[model samples]
Target: MDTAVEEPQPDEFICPICLELLYKPLVLPCGHAGCFWCIHNAMQGLSFSTCPICRQKYNVCPSVCSPFYYYLKTMYPKTFAQREADIKKEEKDMREQSSPSPTMPEGFDPSSPASLFKCEGCHKFAENPGVPACGHLLCDECCVLEKCVVCSLKITYIPNVCASLRDHIHDNYAGLCSSGPLSSSGGGEVRDKFFKVEGPGVKIQMIGDTTARVEIDEENFLHFHLGCDMCGMFPLRGAVYQCLDCPEKVGYDLCSTCYELQKDVNTGKFNQTHTKDHKMVKRPFNVTKHHLILANNP
Candidate 1:
């Protein structure tokens, strides 16, 4: 007696449309495979003239339920049931996870007067208190005076206590803010600009012609500039210098046009000098002409 051999099953194929195990596989001319329902839904709105896979030009309609469906129903019945069960379980879990929680922060009494704290500047009681300048409390108005404590000159309003002090004092004192406004004798006004020089230090107003001031930092460095002084001109004219090696002119200059022209001239001169030097360096072996001839021949 002869025995029969069982054929290997095709259970690993997946449908591209539903992204599940293919229940009814259909192959297009381009050899791409998808489920029957996926292809039908995709072609329903569009003209039924293109292959669903390679999009090859074809006018024939897809064939109806064939041997693929029967094979799926008989061989993979358990797989289909398992996939449906997994989907239902996932949906149930999602619904449970989306439910709201019941909790609140400690000391969150909204109605209690004792829970309220006052703003140092405004003196108004709220849920929070405003702390400024080393735990010093001030009303919002005093905090936003927009004036330097040391000079009394109007400075830009920076909200933080440290930023305000830094702008007012620059980097002068170790801990204390400046004693509001330096006297004019130390650095008198010039061309509507004030200049203050103490020892090797110098402070100049880079902006605001009529009323401006300087602030020093903790390291005694003046880093802040205010106003539209100089109409945005450079601090000095002759401060700019030409480059030593290259024909490039660099450094700070007052006029933008003059600075740009100097840069262009310097760059051109540098390039010319570089080209001449390069040619001279290659003069010992006359190889440049031979290389050029070979390159041209190609």
Candidate 2:
């Protein structure tokens, strides 16, 4: 009996969408990398594009981040070549798999357009437009408008293709991918715990909005529950406190009651244990309120 051997692939080198090695790899905001063509095609016509595997919103369109690409090409040439072949096959399969969308506009060519990016500022198509880190596009004339249309953060421009349109130019792809994942498991969980979010957050007076901003609704409340480290109560809608300390820098939240009595000598509501000498930043609020103080019995 003749038995065939299975080829083992580096898990990090695999793209979930094509189920193959990444070709012209693009490192997504969700940290998942995939074939540039596969990703752009997968995201077409969607209101919002997200990671195909994790469903994390991909607000920014990614280029082939240099480090990872370099590793795949230079360090692991054989594997990289195999992955490239897989990408071509996957692409062909995708084209075959795609049924003409009933709602597709008349005369829409997915391949020709996916590579073409239009500048929002000038409203023109571009071949080599600059792509900002935030995934917005900019044409040559408009690349100078260095602000992300989506995020409003300052943009770094490359002065050629628009953000989404850069996929059209094959020459731009090159890089060294990061080393293998530290642990096969917990990669996603660890990222979720600390990934930076983009939103309209509350601005602190001293630190300014740049260093510290809390994302809240127009009513000034967080989307998630932040429990008070001091009183151990969930500060549901109250003004939460931020500890500018070592471990607490990672989000050791404080409730309003503890905040009000933080300076108390007897109650020890604030500066106790790890919180001692920690400077606290308070989230802004609109509640018209008063603090009722209790006298200490000596």
Candidate 3:
């Protein structure tokens, strides 16, 4: 009998930003897939959210492609495991070899939120630093907040942040749901979210984890509770409205744009039922990037 060694899968699983196995891979609006962190970092300081490969402007946030995910999970478990181990080892080594007693920039406040996370590039609190999927973020000040002094890793800054950071910044915007006469149009578009999507075609997975795209069937989208009933728009700019009396499927949800338009009830800009009579609540639209192939279709 002959023994054969396992080989790593094709480079499809490798992230262009870090040149490593995909970590929390997500599809960009341009039909390319990259690690969540890598995509986020690349989107910073650019006039258009252009894909690194095709230079297509990103119109909205993306989701993880499921077929690609299963290809790695079910088809190449050994490859996935080995890459994960390598990433962990690399991080450990970086942590040990990095500079010690790093100094903070002048006027650096010790009480700042990022004070605890020091950047090696500027020797200061790396406020909103871009964290690479495989290596680390350093000196992203030219592109975004915080100043990492490391300045060694080559990368860029992006407006889209990691799902974890978005969670902490949630609930800052207004929702479409209201108990009585509506308030302002959810105060215009929040523009805080990373992607925009349309109705009837979106394949939503309602899983709680925001780190990576979860693999689910198209039928699973039927159970999504956060869809806007009146509009096909997704949560790229803000949260979708929900109805207290009617189920999301029965036309109770409202997008922020529609909510603010019908503030007077008789304006007819967003002609809908008496929403003020319904009790509704707002939750962060914690959507992550979908798989690349699915993203192109969606």
Candidate 4:
């Protein structure tokens, strides 16, 4: 029996312009093959009219009809058709991808009103209309005002006055005086008087039924006292030396002999003195009295 021989397959054609498989094949004057669309696009705006493959100058374009075109058209018709179809499909897909989606919001659409809300307090445009308690908007004042919404108290502006209001009112009605006036009852009249004349720092007052005022000027070394004279007494070497004459608290100093005698009396050593000797007794060395002294240096 005789066997049938197999036919050789045709070689695939490539486009010279894109270096790819030829689709809608067109042949240049120099016999080079390329896709018709690719060649047309390349030559669209070019001034030089020539065959790209052989550089042969062409004064007028030639007819594209040729035997090679028919051969490719009949032999690989499906491949040529598929390539043309693919190019169209790819172009359609790119255009679809580039076009904006219908779901996306348009530029500055009025459907959402929140984008137009503005703050009333600061007169600044904002996304919300509500005013903050601090009376500041995002676009308005840089700093927030510390103010009470109900009372309208500017707390930040007058902090000291605001803080002192309650205390001042309370102390006024409560009858609670400061230490400067109260210490007078305790024979602090001299210190209190000195402090009043000087300023507000350390002061003294006497603690008794008849209040006395004692002011002390520590810087100037001055002392003053006001009280019933009967209560005023100087402490000399642990013994009280009464100021007999003065009605207000008065200042007194002790001599060396009287101070030694007072010390002996404090140690339980009694010295009997007649009325004449008592009148002639020398003063003690150290005497404790309400007097203003230099506090900083002392």
Candidate 5:
């Protein structure tokens, strides 16, 4: 009797960003799916955001797709469990490295009005707050933006006023609710100050003097029609790393940064059978090279 574990066959369950099993996956308005953190981190929040795979423009970051989350969990328990453990360890390491020190006063009251619900944008008590797709509560009128100021998640649709929270504020903190609007700044001012809209398509900018960094120009660009699986960089510029062992039509590829940093067990984004043991080759962005890779793999 063979008892060896088998790899998951369904490619849709794989996250495009991390190339791993979709953990806490959020389905975008464009109907594509990616891990919640992946989607959140991918968003620049300064302008319109686009889907990693399809390049569909959107402004809001949506909540976790409950059905996809549970279904993946139930259908592929072992794979999902392994992914969870790996992600947890990674998060723990990150937190330990950058965790901030607590600065609570000696006699802090968690139940106080000031300590209760507060808008993430203005830091005022969210009297008449609206709930966005990311589920973070912001005060009315403060919710207007291309991206959420709190979580930096793109705001796809207008946040609806949370009736329950509105009622709660009305019942408990009626004085604050009836006082005036929570934000001192206008929606236009907030939009201007924080959320400036840049062009929608592929964004290019300069990082520093370094020509071989994240910010590169068309002169330094290589891969014409490829994307980095880890960082979700479309039209992957600079050094592109192609997975030699991935057996998918949409070959597993990565940018130079992701290749160096992320070397974990990731199933390829487009259902490719990529594992940690697989070998990768660095290549320039050329149609011939891309076609050759697909031909060899197929």
Candidate 6:
């Protein structure tokens, strides 16, 4: 009898950004997924961020997808635990090398769209910013919560005003920094102002709203016609990215955004062994090719 426990295959559950087991995976609206920190690092604050693979545009990072996060944890406990340990060491090493500097926030630049430090909760320019462990900048007013609304990470350190950052913004980028916090009723005003400034097609997900919607209205969420194989969004909605190369009759399909992000990820939710060699085609919502495949298979 073989008693050795087989290790989980690296190719099955790896994050494209980190090239390791997915940890605290956050599924994007495009149906692609990435590790929380990886997404955080990739996000272009104050502007629309693009999918690392497909370059699909998005703004506001989301919290961890609870279902997928737990599934990976259960399926590959050993590898997940090892990845956690490795990340901790890497973070510690990174912190040790970089002492606090007043040059400017790493991702912030006056010349770029990410010039301002926007609150993750309200999407308002944080005059006095609160830096959390996850590094999602928030206004002091939005920092009242104990957990980060963006990643749901526990706030280990009190969110204090980064004076150095504040001074840098004021001195270098005159008028970019707001003079003070918005009024209590300024949520709408802030949103309107952001829209006017950022222009149309720009979206900023208020982390708090996402939390409330998930808890209060998840059961009432709309279901689409087909499910995305990558994000597990049942009754997949929007543009469907269908694989043209997989031999499985059940078919391999991803959300268009996910298709672009997961080009390297060739596996499927239903056991379709898709590979990088597989070609995919994007189908609009009205297209019946996917339905035809399902109908014929059944």
Please tell me which predicted candidate would have the highest lDDT against the true structure. 5
lDDT of 2 by residue, 1-298 (tens): 7595554454556677877666555655444566666775666221235678767654334544332344345434677787667655864885432111112222334443322234435545444445444334445555456454533544422332222223313223312112322222222321222223332223333355456333324433432334444333322344676666534222455555546745432111122334456666875554221110100110
* TM-score-superior candidate, 1 or 2: 2
lDDT (tens digit, per residue) of candidate 6 on 1-298: 9998896564545676888887766544333557766876776532356667545554434444433444455556788888878876876886421111112333444345333455656777666655543445677776667666754544433434543334434444446665642232110111111111122111223467443111212222222344456544334444667888887666777655466555356355435767887787875434233333333343
Error of 1 at 76 (Å): 2.2
Clashing pairs in 6: 226-236
- Minimum summed lDDT over a 10-residue window in model 5 is located at 185-194
lDDT of 1 by residue, 1-298 (tens): 6585453343345665677866434443223445544653454221123444345432211221222333344445677566546645854874421111112212324443222123323443311111221122223345445542312323222222222112222222323322433232111011111122221112334466566343322222211111011111112111222223433232211122233332222212002222212211100111223223323343
Quantify how close model 3 is to the true structure by its C-alpha RMSD in Å. 24.0
Better of 2 and 4 by lDDT: 2
Report the CA-based lDDT of candidate 5 relative to the real structure: 0.55
- CA lDDT, every model vs. true structure: 0.30, 0.43, 0.39, 0.30, 0.55, 0.51
Q: What is the lDDT of residue 213 in candidate 6?
A: 15
Models 1 onward score TM values of 0.22, 0.32, 0.32, 0.25, 0.34, 0.33
Candidate 6: worst-modelled 10 consecutive residues by lDDT: 186-195
- Per-residue alpha-carbon lDDT of candidate 3 for residues 15-87, written as tens digits (9 for 90 to 100): 7678876654555533345764467456632123666765555533233322234334434577667765775
Candidate 5 lDDT over 81-159, as tens digits, reads 8887887797688652111111232232444534335665776767766655544557766677766675465554554
**Which ranges in model 4 have alpha carbons more than 4 Å from their true place?**
1-12, 44-46, 59-67, 90-298
Regarding lDDT, does 1 or 2 come out ahead? 2
Name model 3 segments beyond 4 Å from true.
Answer: 45-47, 85-298
Q: Where is model 5 more than 4 Å wrong at Cα? A: 1-8, 96-298
